[model samples]
Target: MTKKIENHPIEDVFGDEICEGDTYFVFGNETVLQSNLKQYLIEKQQVQCYEAI
Candidate 1:
């Protein structure tokens, strides 16, 4: 005999992005924002280090 697996609700699986910061973290993984890049450079003062990471 074979057993079947159940799936969780979509909301439970995906969670939620209830604020701007939450949304940013969710989508930011796939794309680099220009302002974030600039701020990183200004804070680090080294482009090579950022690129290496």
Candidate 2:
């Protein structure tokens, strides 16, 4: 099975409930990193991290 990030902005999913100081978790395999939105959230926003199992 393939897991991917939604091709939309985080606000689309979380609505206005999410804020800069709040932390949220997105679950997916390493492939999720391939997504531009996900990559930007991790790299540019510095809100996500990767862990190898």
Write candidate 1's Cα lDDT for 1-53 as tens digits: 32232431222112332333221111333322333545444554465543553
Assess every candidate by TM-score: 0.20, 0.26
lDDT of 2 at 25: 48
Clashes of each: 0, 0
Question: Which structure among the candidates has the greatest lDDT?
Answer: 2
Write model 2 residue lDDT over 1-53, tens digit each, in one string.
44333442344232334333343444452112232456557665689677899
Question: Which TM-score value belongs to model 1?
Answer: 0.20
Compute the lDDT of residue 17 as modeled in candidate 1.
22
| TM-score of model number 2 | 0.26
Worst lDDT 10-window in candidate 2? 27-36
The lDDT values for all models are 0.33, 0.43
